[model samples]
Target: MRRPSLNDLAAFAAVANHRSFRRAADVMGVSRSALSHAIIGLEGKLGVRLFNRTTRSLSLTQAGATLLARLDPVLQDLDRALDTLSEERGTPSGTLRINANKSGARILLANVVPRFLDLYPDVELDLVSEGRLVDIVEQGFDAGVRLLEAVPQDMVAVKFGGDVRFLAVAAPSYLEGIVPPTTPDDLQAYRCIRQRLPSGKRYRWEFAKRGAEIAVDVPGNLTLDDNDLLVQAAADGRGIAYVPEPFAEPLLKTGQLVTILDDWCPPMPGLALYFPRSRHVASPLRAFIDLLKRWDGAR
Candidate 1:
């Protein structure tokens, strides 16, 4: 059998890891049709099918699974070997892919990203922001940014920023001539702009005061996804909205919104940069982490 090229093997790995031709193509900076043709060529060379395809789903065949299991470590070792050359040259040059939630992305953009880019001009940083939590390894991300508490047990987490607080806020007009909620249960008597999570479930409002904690399945006529939208709805007097304090800070300063039950909201663990514990950290990722720590310390 003719040997397949390393590029084809890497392409196969990307598709296997992401389980989507489109996502793999995006990561590889190639067109979907081109990636598909490459895979077809690779399969012809190996004389074995690698993937099971359907209109709605994609999965690996047994041969493909076995190939991936063996290929992952080899590719990782190759990456480390190549990274060594960059390290010897006293420069980190590579693409660094990070999957981050919207809030985490905003924080990094405001603090770490700009400096990191300036310091390592050769490093291509791919930062994808989304609301859904993804398996960083399976998604082919060098690292992930998420709330510290959400980091997987097997991953190493570098906590940064600071504690976060979720606040229940409402427009002053909405509170006019009406009694504001003093306790979690009082939300039952008011309209709330409910939050829909990425998983399609309503987010339960959480509160803490002293030693007591409560989670309220808030009632609402309007349910929306995304923190910004929730904050805007509250500012428009649609209803009370529970969101991260940062999201409502601007409106609160302008008197468009006011915090209610201030004592109930307490700070919790903030965002962290997390990576697989078993993988070797590449030079680019190492430099980025160092910069992240510096920025975090300065904050």
Candidate 2:
């Protein structure tokens, strides 16, 4: 029996993860032919076909799948241990990838991230803003920020901000001479600014008062996916916009926006930072979480 080369095993893992020689090559920073040759050489030595290659696609054999299942975590642990060592040196330095729901990111930008960056200039932060929720572990993100209600209880959760909710608002000109609706059901009579969800359909405007929740499928002349644009349109007298409380706050303060159906807009939940428990907490992530926890306490 002979010991297999670590390089060959790494190539096998790369090919298995990417499911393509070209993509594996791109990730590993090698030529496609070189990556294919490495796989072929390993297969020849082991007397097993690790992948079933077709003209247009690649699929792993049973042996390849089993091998990948074992190597994936081993490689992940190796990387995590290396990052942990770097963090222990009194400098929180590493790439910290974060997936943030729109409002969550907004709050962080205003309140938290600047101070973190100022303290740890060595750390690199990759921030992605998205409307839909993403699985951070599967997507290779270090952490994610979402509404507390949106987070799964299994993950380690850190509350970051105070409770924030949505508010239905309209322009002064739009409400002038028009009776505002007292009940959520009454919104059907007025012009509504409809918002579309990321899933390619209109979002139902949700309202709650006295322990009863109602989702209103109202009519509208304008429809959009972005809350910012919808709020602007509503402020310009197009119709009522169902906007998150923080976004409408400054405008409401300045009398640029007027609230409607306030009682129906009850506070749901604020933001929470979450991550997988299995992975090692990188130093940058630890510091960021500490900062967030302190920020929450201060608020």
Candidate 3:
């Protein structure tokens, strides 16, 4: 067996990281045809199929997955080493990739993006909004933002946003002919707009009463992925929606929607920026963290 060149390995890793030849090529500053040929050449040498390419999607094979797992740490170390050298120049200059959910991304962008960019103009921020909990290290993301409850225990987490609460709300028209739900169990008789997570599971509505917490698997006629849409549907008299307070606040203020179970909704921990504990933090990430800390202190 022959070993692949470092360039070939890096090319393979980029393609695996993005799972799209076009995107990988863009990131590598190469043409799609050229990137494809490089992968083909690497596969010819290894004599293994690394990627399964279909018309609609590209996926990694078993060999590709194993190779990617091995390459992740090496690439991360290389990035950290390069970052260390860049630090000597007294400027953080590199692309920092971040994975976050829709709400988390919104919060981060609203609060820190402008200021962070102003503070460190040399740093590039690549933020991706994903609906599920992802393996940031394995996916080649420098860091991830998530609610404190969703952040993995293995990573170092820094609190950013403040406490958040859920709201059960509906349009006035939708509740005209119905009795409002007083408890979690009462939602069983109500038509709710359910939210589906990225993992394909319908989210259960949660509430707390007295000293006990309950999760209600409420039934619904309309199901969707986005929380904002769910809030809209409820405002349009479709049904009740369980959403974060911030997303539904506008509708509540406009008298389009009214809260039903505010007492049951308790404040929980808000957003946190998290990263792998095993890897050395890059200067770009450290600068962003410092900015976040300052913002938190001021707020």
- Which residue segments of model 1 deviate by more than 4 Å? none
Predictions: Cα RMSD each: 1.7, 3.4, 3.8
In order of appearance, the predictions have TM-scores of 0.94, 0.85, 0.82
Over the full model, what C-alpha lDDT does candidate 3 score relative to the true structure?
0.90
For residues 178-290, what per-residue lDDT tens digits would candidate 1 score against the true structure? 99999999999999999999999999999998989999999989999999999999999999999998889999999999999999998999999999999999999999999
What overall lDDT, based on C-alpha atoms, would model 2 receive against the true structure? Answer: 0.86
Score candidate 1 by TM-score against the native: 0.94
Backbone atom clashes (below 3 Å) for every candidate: 0, 0, 0
Off by over 4 Å in 2: 1-60
Which 10 residues in a row give candidate 1 its minimum summed lDDT? 132-141
Q: In model 2, which residue pairs have backbone atoms overlapping below 3 Å?
A: none
Q: How displaced is residue 1 in candidate 3, in Å?
A: 11
TM-score of 3: 0.82
Measured with C-alpha atoms, the lDDT of residue 256 in candidate 2 is 86
Model 3 regions more than 4 Å off: 1-6, 12-33, 39-77
Please list all clashing residue pairs in model 1, or write none if there are none. none
Q: Write candidate 2's Cα lDDT for 187-265 as tens digits.
A: 9999999998877889999888889999999888899888889888988999999989887888899898999889999
By lDDT, the candidates rank as 1, 3, 2
